[model samples]
Target chain A: MQILDRFRDPETGRALLARVSALAEQAQEKLGRRVVFMEVCGTHTVAISKAGLRSLLDGKLELRSGPGCPVCVTDYGDIDAMVAFGRLPGVTVGTFGDMVRVPGSQTSLEQEKARGADIRVFYSPADAVKWAEANPDREMVFLGVGFETTAPAIALSVAQARALGLKNYSVFLANKVVPPALHALLVDPELRLDGFILPGHVSAIIGRRAYDFIAEEYGLPSVISGFETLDILDALYNLLRQVLAGEARVENGYTRVVKEAGNLRAQALLDQFFEITDVSWRGFGVIPGSGLQWKPEYRDFDARVRFAPEVAEPRIPKGCRCGDLLKGKLTPRECKLFATACTPTHPVGPCMVSTEGACAAFYQYERRSS
Target chain B: MPTGNKSEDVILLAHGDGGRLTHELVTGLFLRHFENRLLRELTDAAAFPVGEGRMAVTTDSFVIDPPFFPGGDIGKLAVCGTVNDLAVSGAEPRYLTVAFLIEEGFPLADLDRVVASMAQACQEAGVQVVAGDTKVVGRGHLDKIFINTTGVGLIRPDVDLGYHRLAPGDLILVNGNMGDHGMAVLAAREGFGFADQVVSDCVALHRITGRLLDELGRGVRLMRDLTRGGLATSAKEIAVSAGMDIWLSESEIPIGLAVQGAAEMLGVDPLYLANEGKFLAVVAPTEVEKALTLLRADELGREARIIGEVKAGGGNVFLKTALGGTKYLDLLAGAPLPRIC
Candidate 1:
């Protein structure tokens, strides 16, 4: 607790903020407009709003949230398939808490659960395996939804099931990788130019060198940051300093956990069971080699191969700007249905439903800032 | 065999059939702990005399998972929850009626412990359990047990606390830390492995509310027990009802180290978590110091502070962050969910 409290010290945060302001002022004058930077992690979006960092740098810099929340970017077709799995008799769908409320083409897992369907929330995929072992008659389908930080754990759960010879256990893989999505965003000619604040947890797995392309190919200053008030402030200070010095490079601000090469053991676990494939994003269309799926040897454990539930075509919720919001093209307030037609209670989009989504975090913490 | 000591018995469906087992359970377990003159009469109703003043009545049900946790249990939570509701209205809690809906096959030892806890809490609060009922359902029909408590109290003649009395410049103060009860219950239920460190603050708050009303009668504008919605929801509701904005200082609000750590790991906001023993009092600016001094002298209000103020605005609540930026506070849309990313 003392170690965590050290990172939240107000005095240290204030010192870093003063330096950020001085550097931000220099960068703004040089750019001839407010310097823009985007945080590409959902947790970073929430921390920035919770700490009021954006408003502190009000006129000197503009902060935008990108496509970082895994739940927000999950294609509607994927949700449709997962929800359909719950409709099958004698089948149980286990997933993280955020996935239950996300609306699919027809209904959500929460709705299906109320109609006598089996849907349970598990903190980890390994718990789902335990549940499957306890209830041998039920077919357990674990929805794998997350990025690099979570992929290794899900892969390990699959491995555990095989080692135990669990015939009733399978995984609905909806996992996406981050770097390819970043490459897709960079190629979009409609979006503007800016630096990036990378995800700390993801970088702890993929490592810092994985993002070298952002500096080498796109020439943007990006810093991998931890999720704390001071960490964010320090990241902003480093980002502004890079802009002021006219240098673009990938820097690791979260050196405590993230190394040059991430956890090799975890990467080896991921590589053991899965292969790269093209995945469809909710807002952005299909990007090449952006998702992970079961390899040939592990195909028998895939939920789609086991259940083969019929899924309808994906349908987008009308008037929802989650797509635009995910790409950092528009703010949540700019949407027509922001507070009037859509809110947290009756969210019309996944961006408002997910806790770490851009719209939900902004609405919860900083809706009154402007 | 109906042993004289039925403490080791498991409750059966016959326990609720108005048979010999029902009578024995009432006389042996409930009556022994909740002994009082009114309940001893064994009448159909509890009749008592009241003075020529207004009275308050409130009811709440407890179905919290695990039923028991560190610092308190569901039995204590039921009594304190209802007592605080009545106390916040400037009423002196006097009587309570408890009812139980228990699952068949529940252990009698566990039932006795729960009833004993309730009896002890009522004894400390100086209230009597004058009436009660018990029903046993089939196995799997209900979770282990559920408790419902209805409280009756007499309103203080001189106390006048209401939203109508609220105005700009009123100061808001809470009794102690936020999010302790919530994080404690969460740790116990989820086994996230910090149950020993964070204990629930499930104590009655009448002593603090009683002192505030007795001393600063007109100065106390409004009082609310922070329960299911915690401080943020209560403040937002008060703001809407009083037609004034509530501005809270993030740095001034007190939070325990264990609670902060648990919330960080779970990715939930402490402001929206539930509290069993915490309440907020809106006092006029003139009596801020006197009110704080009176509150700090009490054990429950030891960590009290002026966390926010009422302002003239369009009925909204805002929190000024530790970094000097403002954020709006609204009712939580849905229950806080743990994040995977």
Candidate 2:
């Protein structure tokens, strides 16, 4: 109660808002145009919507949601492959709840589950290990998904399964790293981003040094931010301050949780179990070194190696501008299929299904007056 | 021979065969707990006295997983659910008819405990169990136990509470903390060990509603029990039904500490979680203070507060967050599941 109450203090929150507004106005005047900043984490996107931070800013600055939601960015072909593995005999699919609703090339895990495929939602990767241990006769296939903050947990689960000699447990690794994806976005000539509000959780694991390239190469001011209202506002203020001062550098706004070097043990675990690979994304397509693949030593724990599921090439949903949305080229309302054809109940794209996806945030929090 | 031991205490198909076993269960277990004149007649149907005013009838089926929880069980939930339904409809619930579908091999002691809890809940609501029936299925055919209750109540002509009666500027009040029942059930099911156990807030709300009706007649415009879809869904339904909009303050909505913590850990929003004992009441702005005072004086309404107000608009529901931003509070799409991040 103390922590949540302090962060949610109305007076202090209002004061921060005023300060952020003043800074944003100064930056806009200095730049002679609207300054755009992107928060590159799905959790930050949800927090922003839940706290109504976007409306509070009200065009003083533009906040674009990037490819932070792992579920939203997972390739349809990979989802199809996982669903196929789940449907195989003697296999139990354990996944995060967000992935169950994401559509594959053929069907979603939820639809497959309704048809009697054994699919279970696990909160953590450790839960999947425990489940595999409990049911020794059946094979457990965990859909390991997320950014660096979650990659180590999956890596640890893999290590744990190997230590226990769990031959029947395997993971379909779709783990993504944030820095490479940010690099992919920065290189796009169409996207002219002024600054970035970095993901706190990922930064906590990979550290502020991971984002040094964005500042050194692209001269973009990047501030690592927490998910709370004040944390986000303070980070926005920092970004504005950097832009107004004509300075582009990495700043740690969430110093309480994130450090410069991050958790070394977690980075070590990631290095031990996974290697960089070219993985497909839902909207952004294939990006080199953006995904994590299981190391050869842990091949027995890789579902792709064990099942070798045959899936067709992924196809984007027609009229869905998720790719454009992820690149900050379009808002949710600008998309043609936003409210009419694509909704949370019947999501046509991964972005609409995931809670942190920009489309879902906009649909759930915005879209009232429209 | 009835043995007072645990070996032969489990239920069997013979208990539903209408033989001596069935009679023993009725007379020895149910009748003993629900001893009233109408049920004492032992007839196929119950005959009760009726009043002249129009009557309200409602029925609900309870198939809650894990029949027993910390604060209450499926039996108590069944009674309170029907009683609250009738209470919000501006009716005095009088008689209830309960039916049970029990699984074979279930412990008879557990059945007895559930029946006793149901009787106790009926007493608290000032209602009587006039009639009942039971059936037993083979093992694996059904969960441990399921309960269905049909309630009959009389509605006064002078009292009219409907969505049509709602108007703009009416203040919305909720009678206690939200999401306690839901979080408690989730924690108990998953065996999430917390220092402080979260118990379900399952209690009857008829007494508080009765007080509000008696004190401020016609001031209460609409009332609804926050159950499966929770307060957000209820508010959305009311808004659509009344052709108006409802605006709520996130800070004003009361959520218990344990509930909030559990919700956050599960990546679920408290607004969509279920509550058995809570209800949302819409009152005229003039009687907002009086309604709040009356609600606060009662044990069940101590945490009650005005969460929002109704406005003439696009028939939507919105929440003004603590950070001075507004967002739509949409109806729940499906079950609230735990997130990965």
In the range A163-231, model 1's lDDT, one tens digit per residue, is: 999999999999999999999999889888569999999999999999999999999999999998999
Write one digit per residue (lDDT tens) for candidate 2, span A62-85.
989888888888887889888888
Q: Which residue runs does candidate 1 get wrong by more than 4 Å?
A: B1-8
**Per-residue lDDT for B1-341 in model 1, tens only?**
24354544788898889899999999999999999999999899999998757899999999999898988998999899999999998899999999999988888988999999999999988899999999999988999899999999998677888999998899999989999998889888877778899999999988889989888979998899998878898998998888889999999998998899889887889999899899999999999999999989999989999999999987788998877867888888877888886
Tens digit per residue, CA lDDT, model 2, B1-341: 34455756899898988899999999999999999999999899998777777899999999987888889999999999999999988899999999999998889999999999999999999999999999999988999899999999998777889988888999999989998888888777776876237888888888898889888889999899999988888998888888899999999999998888778777788898899999999999999999999999999999999999999987799999987799997778768767767
DockQ, cand. 2: 0.63
Quote the positional error of residue B309 for candidate 1 in Å.
Answer: 1.0
Candidate 2 lDDT at A56 equals 88
Top model by lDDT, which number?
Answer: 1
Which residue pairs show backbone clashes in model 2? none
Tell me which residue pairs clash in candidate 1. none
Candidate 2, residue A290: the lDDT equals 93
